[model samples]
Target: MVHTRERSLLPTEEPLSLLRKDGSPVEDSPLTMPDDDVLLELHRRMVVGRRFDTQATALTKQGRLAVYPSSRGQEACEVGSVLAMRAEDWLFPTYRDSVALVTRGVDPAETLTLLQGGWHLGYDPYEHRVGPQCTPLATNTLHAVGFAHAARLKGEDTAALVLLGDGATSEGDTHEALNFAGVWRAPVVFLVQNNGYAISVPLSKQNAAPTLAHKGVGYGVPSVLVDGNDVAAVYAVVREALESGGPTLVEALTYRIEAHTNADDATRYRTSDEVAAWLDRDPVDRIEAYLTSRGLLDPARRSAVAAEAEEFAASVRDKMNVDRTYDPAALFEHVYATPTRHLREQAAALAEELA
Candidate 1:
């Protein structure tokens, strides 16, 4: 007997952008006029995120942190989407989303602690309204869907913004979460930072389909593609989606421009020429140029922002150097609200070994 094989459903590529690479408005783009203040804020946050990435990368090399994921080319996507969120809304971030976490009011010190592996997490999720930085790729999307569903059941008006990468879309959890969010009409934003590669696997190899945004349409969620490097576009799309009060999938077309993580070397898989090409369209430079043209950012103000970022980076470095010892027993304590017998036994055994 012959069996028929099921074909995988994939998303189609969609048209992108409310703004051009040169900050020119795309006539057909859905966004109307861009606010100057919003643009400036986006630019500032991008600079700050870039600075953080740089410092984190250096810290990893110096053995201060276990690992680091550089969001160098994708700062605008994170900062922009973060700026669109309300304080009460929850942010579900991947390990690479340090910028989004910081923009959503997570302390720099807390982020450093998490990155340096001093604790399972540095901040209370309730206090910051940000979920843990999930290291398991696309698993957090389902968590965001559940959180949104719960919020809806509680009659809350807030939404949940879930951040994932292009590679994550390939994960089973990514599709399941999207399906659940759509079926329930959960207030969730599925933000896909399409940085062109999933580790060493380029987007082309990841899927036969053109783009991740199209994945939502079949699930009954509205989707959009945006210039991930253009903070204005990201902010506009995210804000509109949040206001719409339903699931929205946004594929931010950007580039990684760095290694997947500090432990991985890009030189082995990707070429320097590719990195240089993306750097030429650096999101930070684009926003800075726009601000300079509009006189929103003068040299003095720009210098001030740069200096502030430098100081912040220094503070993170200082904090990372501090004593971060934790009780060995505490590890088993937070493993569950109530520990199971096996966990308790393991914890006790570990504690005795340490003692």
Candidate 2:
């Protein structure tokens, strides 16, 4: 009963899933799996990404980080989407997407700098091809669309990917960005990690669309709904979207296993039974199970991955545990291309105060 013409714009009837909860492959999916080596690498990165997420959370408790939004259960979406991007492509991540930043080769400690209350951005966006870890919802989508359009104008093949939450879908900026991208055919991809709740506001209140992907149809963008916890499925769908030569919207059905951040209590809004249900479908465990079942991950390999993750976590801890010192005047230096007289006066006064 599906219409052929609109099929390209609508998401699949069900969230596209390649692997079941038990680690068995779904037969006859049109999506193709990456090479075995790539799959193994995905598993390794997911392990390390999860560890970095946990370590960052621990640092928050120890008073090293001012706050951290844990992406613990969402590693598959975080790692899978980043790995799908080419080196030339740019990524626009939300504040909660530190794991994606890490997967994109950003230093773990640097990625947490903003959350640590130290810097506006922890790393150089130009060098890493990543925007600031955006805190304002849906604003990055517009930035991504503009960047992609500019790249196209310059005759570059570069594209952009922007990650968002379900709540962002309701923002005016998100609507504008999608409309612009669709009209211009900008080489941008919108990845909405629908992690059930957007900081305690369950998606039932944020969106009415059958799936977040369906929102794309109204804007003339092709849409895909995928099981966000399935790393391979996320990788494949995002890769296809990037290669589709136009803006596409992908809705990944995942769950945020942790509280919204160090500041929020999840128990007040959701039940432990709900959390327990998702824990059984844990993304990291599913990938590990599949790999082990295929003999690609034996005890030795598994142990090595765990050890590497632990070492990575230790490195982040060592780097973050130190006192962070900053010069007050340095902030004024980057604020403007040409400092205003008022700014200069304030900077001089601050310098005098410090002296």
Candidate 3:
């Protein structure tokens, strides 16, 4: 059974930072913001992620990839959170979190291969320490909790960061994971990208709670809501929470600003005016403005960054077209570390049927 409780507050109100919207700083945000170099890096990653998402969507439309969930406006939350992790840390990502995987050093080629259904798994989990993108919604949260629990038992200081959407918070697995993490004091960070929609369901319809971060209080996990469009805020919150060494939930309140996936048409549920309002507060634009105001970005450098991102996207597109075929017999390889007799018989039957 899951243990549910009320959400608790951080020691300070500074956790929820809404700074630097529309190219300017708000009067009341965390005083210590990121340095110029760090800000530039955030913008760079955001650009790269956006470019990758565009390319992936195009590939999916071309029938080269099976599916894609674009992180168009949500780049900051993913890149910033992933950037806060140490090299030794583990990341649990959802299908929409390819940007996080990319930032965590997963190869784009392998990621595309996994998305295209060419491989059951992408990169070797041991090598990259990045697990396969969990497509089954909030179920991966439990895996993150369990992994952290095991690591704690083994006396490892490593942490696990799990990324999911706002819609996922409504799932039973999410609640169970939170309860487990809180009870055991697991070193897990739950990063909820509240993009305002869980496919067709709006956030209002997903949960009646005022905020997802508040839900963490009941689980004894400290939680905060941040302007998800602001990469700096995301990095700061995640970095601090990871250092605190217990489960924390960051509800990044941002909008999708794009379709749920290539298969989804968000216009059916949301209005164009809503999408336009979010576009006005675009994460990429905010960073660009900040960089420009500080003289860290100029027209020439901006053009170069865009060109480089495009080149990277083009390379991924070319790589996705390359043949990376696998043997039909290998389909049964990783189902179990040691295949059971039942599985073996089923594999043989399937192989004979195909033949």
Candidate 4:
């Protein structure tokens, strides 16, 4: 009985992976492959997603975006997780997950608005079922848990997927959120994209766990670890978790091939060789190779996908380039339902200055 009780709480012995680095299948893997239609869609989205991430990063250099955390090598994790969810499910993403946001159908321009120094969310949360891209570490997990628990109380079948980094597992809020999700068995999935760094700090310094997925067991949540570069594996794992009807924590072992963000210099801490090794494991290339090997993709299909991605990048570039006027007074409007005396005074002072 004790063994039975603990059976579901432990994570897989190894990080589940469907494909090898050479785009070959893993022998005797535990998970089955997704259907051909699903795999083809994953490949196309990954192509667009990589182009989107590259375009966003370039925007940071061009001063169109204040900053961007490139998800260059982690497209599989971003696209797979989003594609696994149902239309009604909610996604809580970190500031690094702009690719995931785009995969969820949010307008690329609206997705970058927060990084463009805008105070308000560019898109409506209700319409997209996505929260604002959270910059603060691990806080979104708490929100995800609360929303999932509330949905359960209302007898809604909606589930929530919250993305996190390896460093966020050390945050207090993540611990609390996992604990509550476990006890309540809320329909929420916590995806930890362990990209191996928390702003120049390596996982060696940030965590000492056997693996991040093991952190979930302590909170009574089932855990699974997957090779983050394998799109089929990621989609399969996340889709299962969302359909499992209980809280789950999934740790995807990916890497940050680029610097932490446009503002940080990664070379100061990481060696050139380290970055090169991860670049060879590029997620987009892996899926494209796999699809071609299976005859699921040909040169014509590949060229068509590239063309579509270029179109997407062009749209984002055009939208981001258009200049827009801003009103300074709009900042104070959302701070309070009714402005206090001090707030009124500040607004008046700003108004006088503008005049």
Candidate 5:
């Protein structure tokens, strides 16, 4: 499998960005800064997403959630990428992208359902234009490409935003989907949240490329790299990619401050210093500093946001405390319209045992 063909690492162009680590604006982007309202909304969503992560992680520790993946330092990626899409666009998320679901207006309680070992996806995909979060890596791209290509075939102008981790870029399905997307001119944006790891494996071991986004270059898809922690940068880059009317690949340089999940210990792989460096570049803090410097968010406004976040965390805890109990038999209910003979017998045996 090691055909070491040396393909030129040629990419479409440089990545887009609009913010510095200290929250200063970069004058390079042709696009002007987002308006006050847009900035305000971004800040609000980042705050809410962070609080959601905090509450979900706490629930996992309390045994309320079966498992939880915390998107702590990556709020900007979830909020900015999701917000970049138009009303008609679809979002294909990963299991870790519960925050993306939250950004799209899905209830915190319901969005955490599958993570808490509840029912299948709790939201309606058609209504929200968001597909359920996929647990299998790189498979979501297949769904995104198929859905987007079908939309174009049907003469609909809908685009799809698919989120994946750095590890997913290694999967054959990801490569095939990107290759097909370019050939078919599918209006789908592939966003790789390069959080440095696929569980315990770091990006260095994931694949070899000048950059992960370069993989899409072979397929004739334009590529964009951006600082994933910068909300403004991510939102701007993703906005243009989704609107390009063709496939694009965006590699966001971000870090996952938490473990891969509640069951995995990140300390076994990463260092405290590495985590601290990313914590210094925290997305929520950067925007708050930027807005505060411009007087957009004063002390009173900050207090209001704190109160709102606290209320949200309290509600999530309360809802999870009395959330619906998990039923083992419910798994087979929606799996098939007509149960197989073997499945029917198992169902009957289980029902009889329960009775």
Candidate 6:
């Protein structure tokens, strides 16, 4: 049977943007622009998130972390996505989005636990309303939709904001989740960080749509595209989606400048020149330029921010350096409300062997 291929009927629209590579505004400031303080905070958080990624990569080299995924080039996308949510809103992050979790108030050390080979998830998902950093592709998209649906039924004013990569958009679960969300009008915002590559597979190989945002129209969900490297643009797009009380998708056109993870080598598939061009559009540099132009950031403030981030990195290092001895039984603790007979027997056997 020949299946008719789905294609984007409409040409891709121009993505919304507030800032450019030079940090200049794309248009005049709003009546109430993001205050100098909010802009500074956003800049500070992005810098710290970059430092966290670097420190985690270093830990893997030292054999401290089992694996590390550097969110180097996509900081603006992750940071902006999370910061756009309200404190009470929910976040569902992918394994590649430790920066988003950190931006949403997850402790950096705890956020890295799953990546460090620790037992179960690293932090209390309830406390932060941040779901586990999903390793299995597109699985948590379902969870995010369900949670938002439940919140609507409960008459709660919360939205679930979930993040995924361009590659994850290929997964069947992603399609199903978005379909259900559209039908139910679930209060969920899906952030697709279209970083060009789903691991080593480029978007051209995996996607045929004009833009990832176009995927939503089929599901009766609206979508917007953004310059993912622009913090202002990402945050603004996400901010609206989360507040609208219906499913929305934001496709951020960005690039993953690092290997998929510590274990993957990107050099084999991508050219040095391509990576170099992205380096020129680094989000951290762009934000700094904008802040400087507005006179919100100066040399002293820059040094102070660097020092603060360094201190945060040092603390994460110190915490990770301490040896952690997990109780084998804890693995059996959270899988279910009560342990199954088979699990109980296995847990007892492992305990006996250890004893």
Q: What residue runs in model 1 are displaced by over 4 Å at the alpha carbon?
A: 1-15
For each candidate, what TM-score against the reference? Answer: 0.93, 0.95, 0.93, 0.96, 0.94, 0.94
The C-alpha RMSD of each candidate to the native structure, in angstroms, is 6.5, 2.9, 4.2, 3.0, 5.1, 5.5
Compare the candidates by TM-score and give the number of the best one: 4
Give lDDT per model, in order.
0.82, 0.90, 0.84, 0.90, 0.86, 0.87
Alpha-carbon deviation at 34 in model 2, angstroms: 1.9
Candidate 6, position 22, lDDT: 84
lDDT of 2 by residue, 57-117 (tens): 9999999989999988888898999999999999999999999999998988889989987
TM-score quality measure for candidate 2: 0.95
Cα lDDT tens digits, model 3, 4-106, are 3233554244335535677776556643477778788888888988999899989999889988888889998999899888877899999998888888778
Worst 10 residues of 4 by lDDT: 1-10
Error of 3 at 28 (Å): 2.9
Model 6 poorest 10 in a row by lDDT: 1-10
Off by over 4 Å in 5: 1-15
lDDT of 4: 0.90
**Candidate 1 lDDT (Cα, whole model)?**
0.82
Model 4 lDDT tens row, 140-218: 9999999999999999989999999998988999999999999999999999999999888889897778888988879
Clashing pairs in 1: none
- Candidate 6 global TM-score: 0.94
The segments of candidate 2 whose C-alpha lies over 4 angstroms from its true place after superposition are 1-7, 340-355
3 or 4, greater by TM-score: 4
Residues 1-355 of candidate 1 have per-residue lDDT tens digits of: 0112111233334445656667555676556535887787787788777888898888889998888888889898899899988878899999999888878878877876777877888888999899999999899999999999999999998899999999999999999999998899899999999998888898888887557786777898887777888887788778877777788898888998878888897898888888888888788887787778778899998998899889888887887777666776776757788899999889889978988
Per-prediction tally of clashes: 0, 0, 6, 0, 0, 0
